[model samples]
Target: MIQLIECPRDAMQGLPEFIDTAIKAAYINQLIEVGFHTIDFGSFVSPKAIPQMRDTAEVLEMLDLHKAKSKLLAIVANVRGAEDALRFEEIDYLGFPLSVSETFQQRNTNASIAQALETVETIQNLCQTKGKEQVVYLSMGFGNPYGDPFSPDLVAEFVQKLDELEVKTISLSDTIGVATPELITEIFQVQITSFPHITFGAHLHSRVEDINEKVLAGLKGGCRRFDGALKGFGGCPMAKDELIGNMATEVMIETFKEEGYSLDLNQMELEEAIKLSNSIFL
Candidate 1:
């Protein structure tokens, strides 16, 4: 079965306005019933860095997890954040963005590539002890605008390093929405073939028009996991001033259905969540 990860946190984080905690929770609570494999709900990062998500803990508290079929995932930038997320038994996964580009690594997490890898190792150990899983996002996995060295081999090397650390899932992230369909196919094909044990996912950012093509390319290259946000609402604030939105979840659902994939999602609940997103995002 294809794993569809709904990323509400990604949709909300880049917004300049602070969404009320109650509203955030309400929107996410609606998503919880949508039957996504996982919901990327919130982050445990520093409030100063992402003020919009300052109330992540509060949001979690409001969720009706008793009825939730979707697993909860939270983003954490450092060990402190990981520790904070681990405190919540409700969170099933801790996600970290480990950029392949040295420049983006520092920009995104204020750490070098080596430092970030070390952090990943530490976080992995922490997750293992806490009985939670860690998802490492290979940010700038396609290519960066910063003149950094990029190649399919470079991505494979990073995947190799993460594999050594026993990271079970790695999502190749297109931080700047610059990846071509060709690049997506190449990288996913290489990684999926090379690392059979590790689950490779696509966290692609793209123009609205390019969403179907990019997602199709990843599927063609053997990617079964994908990350998407409702209505393509948000992007990495640290990447650039003009954020490129995430792959739209609704559009992705259409594509996946057309491709004859049956997703375990409630159409009624998903429609409700989409309506809720319009209210929260606007």
Candidate 2:
């Protein structure tokens, strides 16, 4: 069975207009009822950086978790953000982006690669203390346009360090959609084989035409966890001039179904969420 993680926070984070807190909570609440394994619903970062998600805490309070079966995950860029997210018992995971591309690492987190590692160590310790799980996203995991050196070895080394820190889950993020099917297969296969204890996920960004190929490659390489957004609403604004939206959840669901992967999703609830998604993103 493949685990699907729906990422509404990634979809809304880059929007120029502010989404009402109530609306955000309502949409997320519907997603919870749809029965995804987890929901990446919001972030606990500086308001100045992502003004759209400033109301994450408030939105979280409004979610009707009484009957929702999905676990909640929140994105955090620093230790401060992690601390804020930790205060909420509703959040089951804290996601932090740790880019291997030196240029993107500084641009995304305002910290160099070394500094980001230190932050990860601190955040990891904090998660352990609080009895919460931490998910590290290796941004630019496939490749980057900044001309920074990237290879399977570099990625392996970074994953080794993360494994040493007892990081249980790491998502290889295609920040700029530069990954090819071959690259995706190779990287995921190596990571899965090398770290048997660590759970690896694919957080891919891709053109609509390339979605199935990318997803297939990841699956073939031993990845059972995937992250995507409804209708593929958002991408990393800092990566390029034009945004390459996230992996569309609808596409992933359809593909998995055709491939005989049982996802345990409610089609009625998913359709309702998709309809609601248009009102939010369109």
Candidate 3:
């Protein structure tokens, strides 16, 4: 069975206007009923970096956790953010973006690659103490536009280092939608083959036309964990050049259905959530 991680936080963080905390909670509460494996709901980072998510804590407090079967995941950029997120016992996963490209590592997290590794160590230790699982997102995992010498070998080295740190869940992120189907298959095949114990996920930003090819490539390469946004509304605003749209959750679900996988999502609640999304976005 595949694990679907619905990324509302990513969809919202790049928006220009702040989504009211009540609206965020209501939408997320409805999403919980749809029974996703996990919900990437919010972030605990500098408000200046992602102003739309400034009220994440307030939204979390308002969620009806008693009705939620989905695990909560929050994005964190540094040790302080991770520490802040850990204060909430309701959060099950703390996701940190560790960019393979030095340029994006500094842009997204304000740290170089080496410094971010140190930060990851600190955050991992803290999560262990707080009983929260740490999820490291290998941002710019496919390729970077900054001319930062990218190849499948570079990705392997980064994953190996993360594995040495004992990070169990690593999501390979195509931050700029630069990944080709062949590239997706090759790297995922290598990583899953190398690290049998780790959970690998594909977080791809894509043009609508590339969705099927990319998603199928990841599946062909043995990835079962995937991340998606409700309507492909958001991407890394901090990425170089033009920002790309996220993979649409509808497409992912449809693709999986065609593959004969039963996700067991509540169709009625999902419809409600989609309507709720229309209200929150824009």
Candidate 4:
């Protein structure tokens, strides 16, 4: 069965509406009860850059992880962010984003892709020292707005770069939500075949209509772990203007449930989660 990694925290990064930690915790607890195998809980980056994630630690304290068998992941931008994230035992995956877009690397975190990769060694060392697993989010593996077209060959090369760095899993992210089904299949297939040993996953961004096609694309390409937001929560304010949100979890569930696939997430529990989200963000 394919595993779903719910990412409400990462998705809600630049939300215009601010849902307090308590409300977020309440909403998240509902998700936890429903049962996703993993979750990208929050980022430990500088609050000045993403004010929404400033409550990372507090949210960790508030979430009810014991309700289900799931891993909680957190995005860490640098060594410092990793350090802060390590202090919390609640986090199971330490996501280190490596952008294929050089311009995006600097604009998002004020560091080049090379510089970000440089920090990976240190971050990996820290994760090992602290006994935590690390995940590499391959952001902008799709087309970049800078007129630099993304290619499967380049994607394979970056996966090789990750292999050389001794990174574990590689998460392909459609940072700008510009990915088509054909593009998704081609990219994942090439990388999965070349890096057969590496754990393959996706962090997708698509409208409600694209859910099944995108999911099937990755599944056909041999991807087992997929990411989604509670209520279509994210779009990088730094990546582009007027972007759609992250792939919505409910939409994915509806598609899969009808197809007789499983997520371990129940329909009633899902409705409660969306209701909470609507109340808080709608």
TM-score per candidate, chains pooled: 0.99, 0.99, 0.98, 0.95
Stretches of candidate 1 exceeding 4 Å from the true structure: none
Task: Choose 2 or 3, whichever is better by lDDT.
Answer: 2
* lDDT of candidate 3 over 1-282, digit per residue (tens): 999999999888888877788888988899899999999999999999889889999999999998778999999999888989999999999999999999999999989999999999998889888888999999999999898878899999999998998999999999999999999999999999999999999999999888988889999999999999887878988896577989988888999999988898999998888888787775
Q: How close is candidate 1 to the true structure, as a TM-score?
A: 0.99
lDDT by residue (tens digit), candidate 1, 174-239: 988999999999899999999999999999999899999998999999999999999998999989
Candidate 2 lDDT at 144 equals: 91
Q: Which portions of model 2 miss their true places by more than 4 Å?
A: none
Candidate 4 C-alpha lDDT tens digits along 70-100: 7889998999999999998778889988888
All candidates' lDDT scores? 0.93, 0.93, 0.91, 0.83
Cα lDDT of model 2 by residue, 52-127, tens digit? 9999999999999998889999999999999999999989999999999999998888999999999999999999
RMSD of each: 0.7, 0.7, 0.9, 1.5
Model 1 weakest 10-residue run by lDDT? 273-282
Clashing pairs in 2: none
Q: What's the true lDDT of residue 216 in model 1?
A: 94
Which segments of model 4 are wrong by more than 4 Å?
A: none
Clashing pairs in 1: none
